[model samples]
Target: MTLRVMVAYATKYGSTAEIAELVAATLRDEGIEAAAAPASRVADVRPYDAVILGSALYMGRWRRDARHFARRHRRALRERAVWVFSSGPLDPSASERDIEPVPSARRAMCRIHAREHVTFGGRLEAGAKGRMAKMILEEDRGGDFRDFDAITKWATATAGEIIALRAEL
Candidate 1:
């Protein structure tokens, strides 16, 4: 059976969306059938064997749709396998430490039990940012800073895990 994977994401200014697209492509390249869609439109999780949900964090919070997506699908996701990633710290100068998980996200994680959760430094486009976003951009130390290589490698590893699980089934 072809593994159905979803790269569901909530993006503010499209950077995270690009990341989600990259992830979906990476999974497809590994022979997993993957789809990319905004989390808000993901009404059903039953069609997918595995899910990779990503969110863009701004002002230390995920977009509302991301939270709602997890809450709505927590039960269904726990029955299968899921993974979560946060794209933020748009400022690479910021410490590359694991963020203190939020209450809602933590509660949902405890219940849904996603296989893995990771945070990666994000990208910033100076032209598109607003006041606060611009402030955040100003603080960036430099470079593309999106870490595409790491993101692609992690995505491949995620697909590998899903492939192994499918084999066992």
Candidate 2:
């Protein structure tokens, strides 16, 4: 059977959404059928053979929509292969090291019995909404810190794992 994957994400300013799009695209390139969508809009997970859920991190926590999505789909998630990611940290830290998921994300992973969780660098360009975003820009601390290479690499590896798991099944 063809393995269908859903790459669902919650984003406040679209960065996480872009990451999700890239992940889905990479998975497709790796021969897995994948679709990217907003977590809030995904009311059903039964159609997907696996799920990769991501969220934008703010103030060291995941966006509310992402947490709610996990809560709403916890049972379905547990029955399928699940992975999670967080996009935040407006620095090269994520590219330099493996950052642990924030407390809430960790809990969600445990709740859903996710196979893995990853943290990716975030982007905060001009016109990004929020006072803190503006403040960071004012401080010259804002830039597109997302590492596309790393994102692609991770997605590729994830696709391989998903394929292997399906073969085992």
Candidate 3:
């Protein structure tokens, strides 16, 4: 059977959503059947064999909808192979090493016993900020910090894991 994966994301300014799309594409290229969708719009996890959830980090927290997505699907997620990712640290000079999923995300991951958790560098667009993002935008240098190669690498590895697991069954 083919591995069916869902790459669901919560984005602010659409950066993380792009990352989720890249991940899904990479997985598909690796021969896994994958789909990317906004976390708020992904009403069910039952159709997927595995899940990769991602969110934009802001104020040291994940977007509320992402958190709710995890909580609402906790049981189903726990039963499947789950991966998590956080996208942030828009300052071009900031080390991606310093970026990681925040506490709330960690808590959710723990509940699902996530297979992996990655923090990817994010992007900042010229005028994508909302009214509330103004303060955070002040600290942002406004650049594309996402590492596409790294994202692809991770997704490829995830696909390998999924394939291996499918073989074991």
Kindly give the number of clashing pairs for every candidate: 0, 0, 0
**In candidate 1, what are the lDDT values of residues 1-169, reduced to their tens digit?**
7899988999888878998999999999999999999999999998899988888877778778788888899888887888888887655532455665555555556767887877777766767557886775577632345778778988999989999999998
- Measured by TM-score, the strongest candidate is 2
Better of 1 and 3 by TM-score: 3
Ranking by TM-score: 2, 3, 1
lDDT of each: 0.81, 0.95, 0.86
Question: How well is each residue in 84-149 modelled by candidate 2, as lDDT tens digits?
Answer: 999999999999999999999998898889999999999999898788888988999888889999
lDDT of 3 at 68: 93
TM-score of each: 0.88, 0.98, 0.91
On a 0 to 100 scale, what is the lDDT of residue 59 in model 3? 74
Best by lDDT: 2
* Candidate 1: segments with Cα more than 4 A from true spot: 93-104, 138-143
lDDT-wise, the better of 2 and 3 is 2
RMSD over all Cα atoms, model 3: 1.9
